[model samples]
Target chain A: MDFTPQELLIASITRMLRGLNHVAVGASSPIPGAAALAARRLSDGHLRVSVLGSRKNNFFTDGGRELFDCAAQGRIDAFFLGGGQIDGQANINLVGTGGYPRTDVRWPGSFGSAYLYFLVPRVILFREEHTPRVFVPKVDFISAPGVSEPNVYRPGGPYALLTGKALFAFDKARQRFRLETVHPGFSVADVEASTGFEFDRTAHVDVTPAPEPELLALLRGPVRDEVAETYPQFAATVMCGSDDKENRV
Target chain B: MAEHGPIVSLDALAAQVPDGALLAVPPDYSGVAMEATRALIRRGVKRLHLVAVPTSGLQAELLIGAGCVETIEAAAITLGEAGPAPRFSAAVKSGAVHIRDATCPAIHAAFQAAEKGIPFMPLRGIIGTDMLRYRTDWRTIQNPLAEGDDPIVLLPAIQPDIALFHVPLADREGNVWIGRRRELVTMAHAAKRTLVTAETIQEQSLLEDERLAAGVIPALYVSAIAEAERGAWPIGLEGRYEPDAAHIADYVRTARSEDGFRAYLAQHVLAGRRAA
Candidate 1:
C-alpha cells in the first residue's frame, strides 16, 4: 500500500515512541499526540504518553492529561518536539526566524519548549519541511540546543532531528549532526541537494518505512478527526498537505 | 485585631469558607494549593467552582475524596492515571464534577467582566463549542443596530467571591511574587477578594527586581496572607521539592470509593481539628 509522506512521518514517529518507556507531548501538537496515542493503543498501553497544556492541574481524568502529567513526573522516557528552524548541531530555534530581539521574521517564540527541552532526556525533533530555511546551517536563535558548543550545557536543547526527506541524529563523539537515515522515495543526493550545509554521510543509510495499513487508518480516523474538531488551523494545514512535495520547505 | 481571626491553620482554611461561596484556585495543582483545597473541604462547603486550566486524575481523586463539595465545574480534565483506572472513571460517571474545555482567556474574560461591573463579554472562537453549554450564563444577543448579521453570544463574567493563590514569596501586607507561572495573575485580577499563601515572607526590597516586581500581586488586592513550609505538599513548586507520591497514591485510593473518601477526610482533616 502506497502511503503519503505525512503518513510515513507519523508512522516513523509512532515506531520511535513504541521503543520508549514514556512520551511527553505538548498542547496543539497533533503529530506527537497522534503518535503517542497510536503507540499506547497499538502497543497494548505499554507506551506511557503524557500531554501538557490540556488541563489545569497535572492530574485529571482526561486522556490528554493522563499522558502529559505522567511525562512531567519523569514518567515519560522520550518526548517529541517540533522546530521552526534547526541547525547542524541540532540547536532548535522556535522563538524567531533569526537572532533574538531582532529577526527577519518572528514566530510565536518558544512556549513550553524551554522547559520541556531542558527536562526531557530524549527529544525527537520533527518538522514537515526539509529546506535551507528550516534545516539551516545554523539557527538564528538558540531557543533549544541539542548539544552545547564548548561551554556547559544550558537549558532548552533538542536531541534529534526528523525531517521530511531524511533523519539526523546528534553524534556525541563529534558534537555534530550526522545523517542517520533517509526516506524510502529519496536518496543521499536528494537529501544533500535540499540541505544548505554539507553533512558527514557514510556509505550506509537506512530507509524510513511507509506507514502500515493500521497506522494510516489510525491517522486518518481518530487522529485527524480529533485534531480537526479541536484545532481548525492545524486541520486546514493537514488537509492541504505540505506546500512543496519534493523539497518540503 | 479581632484576635487574628483564630490564626487559620494551613489545614483548616477550607472550613473557614462559607458554603455556596465561589472559590478561585490556581491553575496548577501545586502542593500549597492542594493543602488549601483539603482544608476547604473539611469546612463543609457545598458548591465548588475551581478556576483551573483543567482537572487531573489526582485532583479529581482529591475532590471526590473531600465529599463536601457537591458540584464542581472546571475548564478541562487531565487524566493522570496510566491507562483507565476504574476509580477515576467512576468519578466522572458520578456527576460530582462536570468537565469543560475552555481556555484561560475565557476564564480571565469572565472574571474581568465581573470586576469591571459588566454583565458579559463577546468572545470569539468558542461559538460552536461545548463551552457555550457549560457556561449557561452565556447568551446570544442580537445586534439590533446591525443591518443583517446573526446575533452573537456573550459570556458573562465569572466573579468569584474569593480568589486563593499560593506563591514562592510574599510580603507581610499580602503582596505576592510568583516566579515562573503567572497563572495566578488572571485569578488575582478576576476575583472579588484575593487570598495568598506563600513559602516565605520577604522584605519589601525583594520587589525591586524589575522582572520579579512585574509579577507581584499588590497588597491592595490581596485580603489575607499565610506563610507555610512545604505548603504545596502533594504538588511541588517549580524549583522546590518533588510532589509527595505517597500522599497522591493515598488520595487516589481513598477517593476511589465514597465510603473511603469520608473516612479519609475524617482522619486527615476533621479529626485533628484545632481552634479556628
Candidate 2:
C-alpha cells in the first residue's frame, strides 16, 4: 500500500513511543500529535496523549502551568522538540540564528524546551527539513543543550531525532547520534550529504520498515479523524487522500 | 464609583492603564483581551512594558505594531499556524522594541514568585541557554540547601502594574470564570490591578456555584470588569468560538507592510469597530 511522507513519519514516531506512559505534543506539531494518538491506539488507550491547543486531547485542568509543573514532577514520559538549528551534540536552537536580542533570522524563541527538555525523559528531537541549515555543527544559540553535567538535576535529554531523511538515536554517553534507520527512498549517502553533523552509523544501516497494514488502517481511520479536530489543515493536506471518501476504511 | 469597582466601559477599562505601566497579558489560547487591546490602542496608551506570560500571538503583535508597547518580554511570540508574527519580528530587528527574551517556565515561575509575594524563584533548566546570558535579572547560584554544587537559575518576581485578559463570564460580584486557564489567576495575583473584559456579566455570583468556584477568580482579585461580547475576537475565546481564520489570514497578509497594517488598523480596529 502506498503512503504519504506524513504517514511514514507518523508511523516511525509511533514506534519510538511504544512503551511511553504519557506523551505531550506542543502547538504546531501535528505530526507528533498524530503519532502520540497513534501510539495511544496501539497501546489500547494505555498511553495518555496531551496535544496542546486541543481541548479533548489535553487533560490539564490547573492551567497552562500544569504541563510544565507536571513535567517538573516527572509525569510526562515523552515529548517532542524542534529547532531552526540542531547541533551534533543534540543542542537545539528554537531561537533564531545570530546574536541575542537582535537575531538576523528569528524563528520563535524557545517556549518550554528550556525547562521540559531537562524534565521529560524521552525528548524526541523532530524537524522535517533535515538539511544542513537545520542540522548544523553548532547552533547559533542553544535553547536547550542535549547533555548536562553530572551535577545538574536533569532527568531528561534527547532520546532520538526523527527527520524526513532518517532516524538517529542519541547516544547520551557518547554525546552523539547513532544512525538507526534511514527512511525509505533515501540512501545513507543522501542522509550524509544533507546532515551537517557526523553520527555513528552501523556498517549496514537498514531502511525504516513501512507502516504495518494494521497501523495504517488505525492511522487512516481514528487517528486521522481525531487529529483533524486540532490540525484540520495538516489532516486535510497530509493525512487525508483525495480518494479517501470513507475515512473509517 | 472607584476605579476598581463594578463593570466599566471598554474605554474606561483601557483608560485605567497608565502610560508605561508593566502590563501582564496571558498567551493567546489562555484568554487574550483583543477588544481591550483595541481600546488601549484607541486610547493611544503608550510605553507599555508588556509581559507575555510564557508566550503570545496576534494580540502582542497588534499592540507592538500600534506603538502601544515599548518593551515585550516573552518566551516566544508567533501567530501559531500562520507562522512568524510579522510586527514583532520587524520591531525586534529594527530595534523598535526592546526584547527581553525568556523561556516559558521562567516566566511562569516569576509570576508564581510574585503571586507568593517572594523576591525571586529558582528554576531548574535554562542553565545552558543564552536566555541566561541576556537575562541579567536572572541569576545562577548553587543550591543553598545542597551540600554540593547544584546550580540553578533564579528569576526575579514579575509584578506587573496591571493584568488584563478576556474571559467567558464575570459575575455581578466581579468574579470572573476562567475555566481551566488558571494562568489568568496567576496574572491577576501577580499584577497590582486586574482588569477584565468578559463576554457577559450575569446577575449570579460566580463563587457561589460549586462547579465554577474552583475556576473563578474571586471579586477581590478582579479590580474592574467590562462586558465586551466576543472580547477575544479574531483570536476567538476557547470553547466559545473558533478563531476567524479568514479574517486573521487577511491580517497576516495586510500587516506585512506598514501602509497595509495602518489600513487594517483603520478599517478593523480604529473604525469604531468594537467587539460586537
Candidate 3:
C-alpha cells in the first residue's frame, strides 16, 4: 500500500507502544493521538488510550490534574513529548531559543513535561522536522532533562527519539541517543547531516519498515475518523484523502 | 444568608476584578470566561497577575496583547492547532510580562496546596531543568522520611485574588455547576474570591439535583454570579457549541501585529460590547 509519511510515523509510534497498558497523548498532538488509537486497536482493546482535549477518549474524571496524578501513581505506561529543540543527551527544550525569560524565539512553554518526564516510564520524543536547529548540540534551555540525578525522584525518562528522518533509541544509562533505524529514502549520512548533536550509530542501521496494507487501511479508515474528532485539520489535510468538511472539529 | 446575591451584569462582574489583581483563569478547552475577559479588557484593567491553572490560550494572549497582564504563571501558552499565541510570544520576547514558568503538575499541585491551606507542596521531577533556576519561589528539599538521599521540588502555594470562569449553569442561589471540569472547584477554593459567569441562571438550586450535586461548586466559594448567554463565545462551551474555528483563525491572522490586534480589539471586542 502507498502510505503517507504521517501513516508511516503513526505505524512507527504504534509499534513502540506495544506493551504499554495505557498511553496518553497530550494536546495539539495528532500523530501521537492517532498512533495511540491504533495501538489500542491492535491490542484488542487491551491498551487504553487517552487523548487530552477529546471528550470521548479521555477517562480522567478529576479534571486536568488527574492525568498527572495517574502518571505519578504509575498508571500511565507511555506518553509522547515534542520539543522546539532536543539535544544529544535527550534534553528537550519546549521553552524557546536563547537565554531564560528573554528568549530569541519563544515556542510554547513546557506543559507537563517537567513532571511527566519523571513519572511516565516510556516517553517517546517525537519531532517531525529533523533539522540541525531542532536536533541541536545542546538545547538553549532544558524544559525537561532527558536524564536526572540518582537522588532525584524520577522513574521516567526518554526511551526513544523518532523524527521524520530516522528512529533512535535513547540509552538512558549512557545519556545519549543511538541510531536504530533510518526511514526509507533517508540515508545514515542524511540523518547525520541534518542532526546538530553527536549520536552513536549501530554498525548496520536497519531500514524502518513500511506500514502494512492492513495497518494502512486501519489508519485511513477508523483511525482517521477517530483522530478527526480531536485534530480535524490534521485528519483532513494529512490523513490521506479525507475532505469531509462536516467532520471538522 | 447567601454567600452571593443576585446575578450582576457582565461589566459589573468585570468591575469586581481590581487592577493588578492576581486573577486565575482556566485553560481553553475547560470553561473560560471569554466574555468576562473582554469586559476586563474594556475596563482597561492593568497589571493582572494571571494564573493559568495549567495552561492557557486565546484569552491570555488577548489580555497580554491588550496590555492587561503584568505577570503570567502558566505551564504553557499556545493557540492549540492554530499555532503559537502571537501576542504572548511578542510580550515574552520584549520582556513585557514576567513569566513564572511552571510544569502542569506543579501548577496543579500549588493550587491544591492553596486549596488545602498548606504553605507548600512537594512534587517529583523538575530537579535538573532550568525551571528550577528561574522559578526562585520553588524550592528543593530532601525527603525527611526516606532513608536514601531523595530530593523533591517544593512549590509555594499560589492563592489568587480572584478566580473567574464561565459555566453552563449557575443557580439563583449562586451554586455553579461545573460538571466534570473540577479544576474550577480547585480554582474557587484556592482564590480569595470567585467570580462566575454562566450561560443561564437556572430556577432551581443545582445541589437539589442529586446527579449534579457532585459537579456543583457550592455558593460558599462563589462571591458573585453573572448571567451572560453564550459567554464562552468563540472558545465555546462543552456540549453547547463547537469552537468558531473561522473566527479563531481570523483572530490568529489579525493578532499577528500590534496594529492588527488593535483593529481586532476595536471591531470585535470594544465595538461588539456595545451591541452585546
Per-prediction DockQ comes to 0.03, 0.78, 0.86
Task: Summing lDDT over every window of 10 consecutive residues in candidate 2 chain B, give the lowest-scoring window.
Answer: B1-10
Q: What's the ranking of the predictions by lDDT, best on top? A: 3, 2, 1
| Clashes by residue pair, model 3 | none
Q: Compared with the true structure, what per-residue lDDT tens digits does model 1 show for residues A112-211? A: 3433454466788888788888878877666555664332223233556778898787675676778888998789888888887667778889887667
lDDT of 3 at B121: 93
With a 3 Å backbone cut-off (N, CA, C), the pairs that clash in candidate 2 are: none
Better of 1 and 2 by TM-score: 2
What ranking of all candidate models by DockQ puts the best one first?
3, 2, 1
> Which residue ranges in model 1 land beyond 4 Å of their true spot?
A1-249, B1-16, B29-32, B53-61, B79-92, B95-104, B130-135, B141-152, B266-276
- Which one is best on lDDT? 3
Off by over 4 Å in 2: A242-249, B1-4
The residue-by-residue lDDT of candidate 1 on B66-155, one tens digit each, is: 544444444433323212223334444554444333443455456657767798876432333323444566676665566765455576
Per DockQ, the best of the predicted structures is 3
Q: TM-score of the candidate numbered 3?
A: 0.97
TM-score of chain A of each: 0.79, 0.96, 0.96
Worst 10 residues of 1 chain A by lDDT: A56-65
Per-candidate TM equals: 0.51, 0.97, 0.97
State the displacement of the C-alpha of residue B236, model 1, in Å, after optimal TM-score superposition: 1.9
